[model samples]
Structure formats: C-alpha cells, structure tokens
Target: MSNRTGLARVLDDLGTTLIDLVRGDPARAGGIGGVVIDDPHDDQVLPPRALVLGVGVREPADVRARLDELGVLGAAGLVVRGPVVLTDEVAAAADRSGVALLGLAPGASWTQLAALLRSLLAEGEVTDSETLGGTPAGDLFALANAVASLISAPVTIEDRSSRVLAFSGRQEQADASRVQTILGRQVPARYSQLLEARGVFRRLYRSDQPVYIADLPDDDGGVCLPRVAVAVRAGDEVLGSIWAAVRAPLPADRELAFCDAAKLVALHLMRQRAGADVERRLRADLVSTAVEGGAGAAEAVRRLGLTDQECVVLVLALADSHVDDPAEHARLLAERQQVADAFAMHLTAVHPRAAAALVGDVAYAILPTESEDRALRIATDFRTRIGDRVVVGVGPVADGLTLARSKAGADLALRVLRAGRSQRAVARVSDVHSEGLLLELADLIAERGDTLTGPVARLIDYDLRHNGNLVETLSAWLDAFGDVAAASAAVFVHPNTFRYRLRRLAEVGELDLTDPDARFAAMLQLRLWRPV
Candidate 1:
C-alpha cells in the first residue's frame, strides 16, 4: 500500500472487526471463546492495534494459513478451542505459520473478546493523536516530541550531511569537543549517494506523504550507517531524513512516518541548498572579478587569503577530460597540506595550474622559495604521478610586487619552450635575454631561413640530403654533351657513345665547396639553436 494511506478511524473499531466472524457462525458460538489482542507497545503494526483473527472451536484446515495471510492483512491472534478438528500434521503446520493459537472456548464468548479489545484499543488512545506534520515544523515537532516520549531508544533528525537538526528526548547528541576536531572530522560524501534518495524526497515533499525503505543500505561500501532513513521533501527540494535503527526491520507504520520525516527534511534542504548555491556563485564571481587583467595572478592570491611571499610559479597543462571538474579541483586544493609537507625545506608555494590547485588540463602555481630546482621537482613529480602532459614554467624569485612580474616571466618561459623543445620546470623566462649574442645569431638564421623559404631552400635541403649525391644532375649534363669523344674524354667518360653527362659542381655539395663563410655561419647557427 502507498504510505499516503493514513488511517482515519480509531483502532478500537478496527479491533471490533475480529469479533464479527464468531457472531455469524453456527457450530462455533459456544465452541469459541473470547479473543485476545496484544498491545503493540510502540511496536508498529498495521491496522495498528493488535486484532484477533478467529476465536473458538476446531479451526478449519486453512484457518492458520488464512490467519497467516491475514497477518499480512494485519491480524494478530486466533482464539480456538483445545480440541481442533485439524489433523496432527495440520496443527503442527499452524504453529510454524506464526498464528497465535489460544484455547478460550470453555468460558469466554465473542462478545467478551470484542469488549476486551475495544477497551484496550480505547485505553491506548491510538485514535486521538494521528497528525503527521501537515508541512509544518510545529506539527513535526509535536509528533516528534510524542514519539520521543514513546521510544526508549535515542532518535535523531539529520540532514543528508549527517548534521543533526532536531533531536529530542534525553538522548545525548554526539559531543562536539570530544576527539572530534582534534583527530578527524566526520564529513559525509553525500554527493555520491544523494542521487538515490533525491527522487523520493522530491515526491514526498510535493505530496506531503511519507517515503519508506524496507531494505536500507544506502551505500554498500560500509562506511555509511546501514540504517533506513526516511526522507521528506518539499517540491523539488530535499531536506533530510528521519533515522530510526531500533527495530530489527522497520514496521509499515514507522516506515510511513519515516517517509513523512523525509518530506520534512526535503522541504528544508531545498530552500537551504538554493540559498547556499546562490552564495557560492556570488563568492565565485567575486573571487573571479577580484583577479583580472595583468594583476590577475596577484589579485587571485590576495583574494584567496593566502600569503604571497612564499609563492613560486609553476605552469602545467593536461591532455585529458579533467578541465573543470569541481570535486577534483577541491581535492587538489585539499592536497595543499601534503604539498606543504613535501616542500617543507625548500620554499613556500602558491600552487598554480589552471585551477587554484592546478589539477586541470592547464595550470601554474607560484612557489615562494628561491630554488627553481625544488619547485620544478615538485611540479614534475605531480605531473608524473598524475600522468598528464604538463609544462613547468618556473618564475624567478621576486619579492612581493615583483612576483607579479615573475608570473609574466613564467609566461615567457613557455614561449621559449614552444620555439624549440620542451624544458624542465627549473627553466624560467627571465633567464633569456633577447639581445644576447646567441639569440641574435638564431634570429639571423630564422630570418635567412624565411627568405630562402621556397625552392632555393628546398634545393639546399635536397643537396644536403642523400649524402650530397649529385650523380643524377651530373648524368643529365653528360647526356647534353652528346657523346663527343673530345668532351667525353675531358670528363673522363668511357665508351664510344659518351652518353653520360658530366657531374654538376653545384649538385656535388658533398665536397663542402671549401667556403669558409658558409661553414662559419653553419657552425654559429648550430651553436645558437637553443635561444634560451
């Protein structure tokens, strides 16, 4: 049945239903005795109060089976005579089926059984208090207060984060000071499992009904408590759950109430989560806005409330899907403590990459210490462990405002890297001077290479290629000489035809041509190949 099917009439009247069967029976009048109903005593039973099934005489063969079926339909006990008509096999079968078999036929009547149940149901006052929070905290509080009074075990109301909100009765909430902050904090990973309960909370909160989980392991990983949490939500909003763990398996009514509690939590969670979202967005916006333009890296450091003096810059890039994952970013940020430990003796570092933690496809962090080697080591280590393509641009050691310029230097180091080959993290941009003699030499070659960009460059390239063999062009010249005995003899060609062309001087670049200027330029260009 849906949890929304709240019972309207009292248990007293429902208790009377058990008596009607005996009244209509013929041979079973005096053969049946009074009925007995057990008080639930905080045991959540459906039909709610304990109710009788059948009382008196030998039971029909299917009576216990029928009672077993009715137990699910919400039956409690059956008052049958001692001498049952059923065979021994059948009587034994009844015992195993969980039907309460009692002998009351000799003295009591159906009327007496009905009266007793009615009296008990009335005295228990099951009908008087049945309101389960009509979307009102007052209502929940009222019900919760009463439930706390009834329950012997401690009860707690917590959000998805496991932070207790409303707890009642004498149950002590976990002590905040006792080994909590000193050792470890109990932070729940709700984002991992919130997806499952989110749907139910949405439904319950909208309908103001209850949600139930009969089998209650939220996370099979064992860290999460394996208890059923009933959730209540307000339209599209999830608040929290009502946690109950006293019962072996939760009864239907308690399940229903848990659902109600879920709705309660959902209503609260939705509203709270929304405002929290806005606040986060605003904070993100402000932080971003605070750090823009040339002052961006510096401003970012300032906005993050971290000291900038100990920062050293290291740039990194990735080749995977981790461009902007928030959780991963947070994890990288949290790794700061470990990073500090790793670099304890070197220098203070402002972790940089694309994100504050530099865990993304591209990022750079400024290390505070002067040792570029140590910073590079740390950055390179991170790159290796994460197995991502990262370019480490080590910024020079600069004090305060100069650090901003150092970040600029990091950018330049990366530019130098692109011009040639990859570099280690220890390579900084400031190490290069544009006016240096080597740089000037490389610049000359670059311009020369550009001017000879087409066929001339291709010719030089080809001549230098294939071990500088000019044989093909030489043969062509020889063929043009037309086999003249005199011309052929001049070029030392054998045979009367003399068809082979003379070797071309330009094509035979293998001789090095004995040109001092060209040789000198080539050597200088090779020496200056590394602009840095």
Candidate 2:
C-alpha cells in the first residue's frame, strides 16, 4: 500500500460530478502526503503533494494569490466549495501551478471533506509504504503486484504508448487476453484494433472514472471477462492506464482503492519518465555526433557504450499529409516519440547495439550491421509490425569512420522515396537505380552546369525551340542501349524515321553516337536535365 495519492484518485473517491470544474492536470495532482488548511495570517509552505487550503477562509482570488506566492511550494491541488464561482484568474493560476482546482458538493462541509481526505490518506499508509528514489523500475513493478493483490485481480501497468511497464502476479482466473497482453508486454495489435474501434482510448483520456468494457471478444471466438481501467495521468496528459479484468464489477471500495493504485502508478511513471529523459539526452548527444561525424567521434561512440562495427543508419518518416493545424504538431510529436520508442524496442531484439530516436519527425536508428539483406528484412519486419504508414530509408553500411556517409546515404534514400511520389514502404541506397543516382548527381552539380553541358543542352534547346523530339529520341535510343529497333519502337516511330532523327539529333548536338561512354554520359544528362 503506497502512501502516494494522486489528484485524480482524490477526485475519483469524491466523484467528479459532485465537484464543479476548474483547470489543472489530474495526473499531476496526486501524491499527497497530507492536507493543509490555508490560513491567511499564517505564513508556512508545505512541500510537494500538499493539497493546501480548505474552503471558506480564503476567497478564490486570495487562494490564487497564495498559490502564486507559494510558487514551487504550491499544493498538489486546491479545494473549494461547489457554490464558489471560479474566475479566469484562479483558473489560470491553477494551470500555471500544475495543481488541480476542485470543488466539493454544493452543500458539502469543507472541514468534513478535509477530514475525509485525512482518513483516506491514513488508510492508504500501508506497512510497506514505499519511498521515492533508488530504483524506480523495480519499485513500480512491486507496486503493481501489490495493487493486484489489493483488488484481488490481475493488474498490468502500461506507458502512454500502451507498452506494458509492469504486471501483477497472474491470478487463477486470468483471461486469455490478459495472458496474451502480459506475454507480449503490450496489447496485441488485433485486440488494440478492436478497442480503438470501440472508443476505449477516447473514453479513457476523457474520464477519471473507471471505464468498464463488457465482453471483449477474442479472435478465436472466445469472449474475455469484463475489464475496468483508469488512466494514469500527469496533469492533463495521460501517462498510461492501469487495467484489471474480473468476472464481476469492482465494488465501490475496490474502485476507490484502484484509483489509489493509479496514483502510485503515476509516481513510479514520473520516476521512469525522469530516467528516460536522462537517457534520451545522452542518446541524443551520441546520435548527433554519430550522424554528423567529426574528430573524436570514436571517443563519443565509446562514451555512448557503442563498439566499433559496421552499421547502417535507418531513417523513418511518418505520414503527416493532413496535418494542417498548428495544434496538431504536439500530438504529432508525442506520436513520433511513441513510434521511436517502439522502433528502438523492436530493434533491440534483432541487434544488441541497435538504438533509435526521433530527431524531429524522422525516426533514426543506428543498427550494428552492414548487411543490406538484413537491413531490408528489418525494415520489412518493422513495417509489418509498426504499420504501413511508416516509410523506411536504409543507408549503405559504414564503419564508425564513415558514419557521416551512411547518414547521407540514408537521407538520399529518403529523398528518393519522397521524390518518387508513390506509396513505398522501404527504400534502400542499394535499391536506387542509375537514373535516380543520375538525377541526384545532376541536382548536386546543377549549380556548376557541368553535367548539363554542350551536346545535351544543345539537343534540349533545339527540341524546345522546334517542338521536335530529338532529345526524346536520343534518350530512348540511349535507354535502349543503342538498340535502334527497340529505341524506334519505344518512341512509337518507324526505324527509318528514328534513324533520320538520330542523324539530325547527333549533327545538331555535335556528338558521336558510337562511343559507349559518350552515350552513357548523354543518357545521364538526358535523365537529369529535364526542361524547366
């Protein structure tokens, strides 16, 4: 029994509808050690988790001012009378403080509500009251197991991305869905698909109450037992969900206890998030250095705990064609982080040194392998697992010394995929054809005007001026590898007409058609120097 209580749990116990609305994140609201009754004359500050000030003594404005003065020492949330009208200023203060602003029932006694909270807190202080710090991951799992025991049901804790963080000991009555979800450490895609269609997530994010789902049918034609879930939130953001499957509905007491469990989960999740942030910072430095490549890069790699080995850098871009509104950017970023974490997790199973992170909208992975075949297989497997919307670009293999080159190759592959302007799941540097390479090279040298010179330009200029097909003819002939009959057929013309066009084209362009090198150069220029 963790002593931690979240603002959401308090609201759940009190019943949200009994209280009037204000602004704040419920997920960040809880973890209260004790309640403080604010006194205007008394100048004292309580640390984190203090839900300071009961109703009556302080007006909402006074409370807001007190909270502003408290600053970092402000309460986990503020309580008020239901009939008290809240102002925009108070609401704005709550938002800035990251504390929940809640109101009790219209006629509810503030002292009585404060006493109820004290009782609840006293009830929650278990013999095994866990403290923060140390190893948060281990503590989190232990807490999950305790929650399951308390509720007499199996419990699974998950992150915002629905990836399982921990699970309680399996009960004898555990259902197939529970077993499968535990085994995978994530909800099965098929089950997730079904739940998404049913608006389970939509309801989870919107409500503090336990969302109850009835009779979830499995693919094997078996129905799962009813499940109840509560979102583990931090402020307004949902950290994840805590779920329990049971044959019967959880009693009122048990439901309240479950909400208490959500607070403990939130505590553990906050710690985990802190740890991940540190890791991301470290990984970001390593990734930036590895991609950019400079002096002492090997030292940086070693610092990142990476070994010198052949590797391929993969770049994955999410499909965001319909993202028109600026508000959608944050959602896209969150989604990108989830996708990056998922990709990193999956890559780890395949290669020990594989690491992934999203630098903006693109998810990049540095995999410890040079094999193109392996890279392709990994890309295909990721696409199948992640979704078709993710487009993967695989770079050519390079050692630590040439990682910058690999990064460039990956970028080029992604560019080619984008330029193709078609639906493609994966693009590899190796998969790029000569024409694509020519086009890229042409773009690279376009400023210098070296590639698109002399004969090629002359032929292009003549065709544009006369509306003739000399350039097309030469291109077709070159593409056909000097096969006159094939070139003529490709251009939808007779061989005699193609021969005459070829002669005219060569004479006007001042070039020879016989030299293979010359023909290859001409073909390269033709593919690249498209008319403006």
- Predictions: Cα RMSD each: 26.6, 21.4
Model 1 spans with C-alpha error above 4 angstroms: 1-226, 230-244, 248-301, 306-310, 320-361, 389-391, 412-420, 423-532
Tens digits of per-residue lDDT for model 2 on 469-499? Answer: 9988888888888899999999899999999
- Candidate 2 positional error at 242, Å: 4.8
Query: Which segments of model 2 are wrong by more than 4 Å?
Result: 1-138, 148-165, 173-231, 237-259, 316-342, 370-373, 380-397, 409-418, 421-440, 449-453, 507-521
At residue 343, candidate 2 shows an lDDT of 88
* Winning candidate number (TM-score): 2
When summed lDDT is taken over every stretch of 10 residues in candidate 2, the lowest stretch is 129-138
TM-score of each: 0.37, 0.56
lDDT of 2: 0.72
Cα error, candidate 1, residue 480 (Å): 38
- Model 2, residue 361: distance off in Å is 4.4
